[model samples]
Structures are given as C-alpha cells and as structure tokens.
Target chain A: GAGVSQTPSNKVTEKGKYVELRCDPISGHTALYWYRQSLGQGPEFLIYFQGTGAADDSGLPNDRFFAVRPEGSVSTLKIQRTERGDSAVYLCASSLELAGGGNTQYFGPGTRLTVL
Target chain B: AQSVSQHNHHVILSEAASLELGCNYSYGGTVNLFWYVQYPGQHLQLLLKYFSGDPLVKGIKGFEAEFIKSKFSFNLRKPSVQWSDTAEYFCAVSGYSGAGSYQLTFGKGTKLSVIP
Candidate 1:
C-alpha cells in the first residue's frame, strides 16, 4: 500500500503571498493531522480531522492558517499572507481510526515551505 | 497545557554500545506515549507506543520504551546500536481529551549519531 504523501516537496514563495500545501493520507485512514516543524525543533501540532470535520484546531497559530478535508481523504493546508516565520516543514499524518489512546499515526514526507 | 521533554539534544555512540534516550511528559490525565524516528531526508516513522497494560513496550529495530506512570516518563532504550541508527528521535505524548479526540505534543528531538 502507498504511504502518506505530500505534493510539492519544496516550495519557495515571497512573504505575504498565499500558499497551499496538499496531503494524501493512506487508504482507509479516517483521522488526519497537520503539523509544522521548524529548524532544530520538533513538530508542532496544527490541526486534526475526523472524517470530514475538524476534530481539534486549537493548534492552528492564527486565522491566516486553515485546513480542510472535504471528502475525508485528502487535505489541504492554506496560508494567507504567509510570513517568513511560517517557513518550515509542513507534515501530514493519518491513522486507521481515532482510538482514543491507541491510534498510531503514519507520517508523510514533509513539504518544506520557504517564505522569503 | 501538555508538554513533552527530551533530556538529550545530541548523543554520540559506537557500534554495539547500549543506547538510552530520556523522555518526560507533563499532563494531568491518561496519556499515550510514542517514539518516532526520522532518518535524514526521510519521513517520520513510528518506533513504539504505550497505551496501557504493560509498562514496557518494544518496537522495531530493536528499540524499546518503558512507561513509568508515577515518574511521568517514557524513555527509549536499545541494547546495542548500529551505524544505521543515526537519526533524529522524537518523543510525543497524546492525551485522551474525553471528547473522542487526541492531540499530540512533541518534544525537541534528540539527534543520535552511531559511529561504526
């Protein structure tokens, strides 16, 4: 089976521009999550989706950052007025189901977003 | 309100040497613990997890972690290491929110270098 995958392995954009990152989770996975990893740091949670609805979005830094999983399979993270501070690796993960405390998330090769 | 801590930022060891990476978390409720590894230029991979029952959990590549509830710790260990083990190891914790959702909090990763 194909693992989780992300498009545009690398993206370079000017500050204040709009950017969108895509993610394709594994087949049959109903829980999807988004994270951001900065240099020399661990991944920071951004958002999580259960089915077609976002279960928890408290991790989102601000209103400029939004994500959607319209069909409950693929997800897209959108950033409006991107800032240089937003430059980091965007990661996506998915799991078989939301099992309270036992679900194991499989991650994708992150999309490195560079904001100049 | 939830946070994870990785005591070691970097470690160097030789082949056949024992390995230990310290991890501690601060959360008031029941939590799930995990260890993830990311090789250079590779996606993050799950090494192990602890949900319940046994405190000691084993993972792939001869890795293991012991969950100590009283100490609020889940430390990763291996009897011997190989050159291939050089990578970044992350400690993450997900708390059961009682609302059917789990959000992960990751620590600053530890970079392990194994000399051949």
Candidate 2:
C-alpha cells in the first residue's frame, strides 16, 4: 500500500464491550506505531514495534490495552471492557526504519472509536 | 518522563497574517522533533521535522520550524497564513534509543482558525 491503512473508520460500541482495531502499514515499512487522540487533544503514543517484536509498549495506558504486530506488517489493538474514557481516535503510523535518519512516519486516516 | 508543551491552545488570524506556534520539549539525551498538522476531518500529516544540523528547517506549505537545542524548543512559523492553514497543529518529540525503539510524545495541540 502507498500509505498506512486502518479498519473500521468509525466504531460505536457500548461501554464494557470488547473491541479490536486493526492497522495495515505501508509496504516495506519496518516500524509501526499506535497512538490515541482525544477530542481537542494531540495524539499520544501507545505502542511501537520493530519487525515482529514490540520494541516499546510503555505508553499503553493499562493492562486493559494490548497491541500485537505478529507479522511486522499488520497490527491489532485490543481493548477489554472498554470505558467511556476510551472514546477517541486511534491512529496508526509506519516508517521505513527507526534509525533516526529522518524516517518520516506516514499516518493512517485513523479509527474513530466511540464508547457509548 | 519526556513531555512536549504547546503554548497556545487556540489562535485566530486573518489571511496573510504572520503565524507562529511555540513548542518546547524536556529531554536530556538526543532526540528528534517534529510538527504535524490535521485538517478538519482529515488525518495527521507531517509538517516538518528536525533531526540534526540545521536549527532552522523548512517544510511544505511555506511552513518552517527552528530547533533550538539549548532551550529545548522547536517552534513552527509561517511568514503568511492562509485560510487553508486553519487546522490543528501538534508538536512532537521522539526519544532516541540504541535499540531502534522510537516513541513520539506529542503536545496537547493548538487549533488555528484562519479567517478569510
């Protein structure tokens, strides 16, 4: 793909329900990241992966949030017992590598998750 | 913990007016800085980034940012603003680790309303 892509552009789920958001990174991108953005706020880091391993997951809010990049290409973010506070836009981004040589991250359209 | 701060939460300007958005970060080690923009109903896009060398970096749409290492600041500026520049601007900083784990920390964001 030319750019990162996410599934379920909009999701409205009841509180306490389980939900999963998916991300498909750009082709040949070796690094993938997940972020969360609330209304009127900027995006916050969630998780980062290099290849198939999660290089950094410290940004996860709590145990209720988990993300996995099994094949280093497609990733899934799972939330257990979602709460109203979880309502926000989930963004996904990918870069060629994280070597710091000006690896520009291309972002997806984002999945707007609304917990009702 | 490293954090990014944006001075203004909201700003209003007329077309052709000069624009400036303040960004500051707190990090002791080497880091990369970036600016991202989000138009209404659109995804986040890269405005500019600073990795090393030049303190002043130019970006698309006549936007530029200056990275001041001593002050830990990377401020975005535009000589002339246009109505199309009305959007949310975010300042981000990514910590550099040897393991290639790059996680970006973003400010709360500043909304710019450019009146035509």
Query: DockQ score of candidate 2?
Result: 0.70
- Residue by residue across A26-98, what tens digits does model 1's lDDT show? 9999999999999999999899999999988888999999999999999999999999999999999999774
Task: Tell me how many clashing residue pairs each candidate has.
Answer: 0, 0
| TM-score of chain A considered alone, across all candidate predictions | 0.98, 0.96
DockQ each candidate and list the results: 0.78, 0.70
**List of clashing residue pairs for candidate 2:** none
lDDT of 2 by residue, B1-116 (tens): 67999999999999999999999999878888999999998889999999988899999999999998889899999999999999999999887754456778899999999999
| TM-score of every candidate | 0.97, 0.95
| Top candidate, metric lDDT | 1
Residue B98 in candidate 1, Cα distance off native in Å: 5.5
Best candidate per TM-score, number? 1
**Candidate 1 docking category?**
medium
Q: What i-RMS does each candidate reach, in Å?
A: 1.3, 1.7
What's the C-alpha lDDT at position B15 in model 1? Answer: 97
Question: Poorest 10 consecutive residues of model 2 chain A by lDDT?
Answer: A96-105
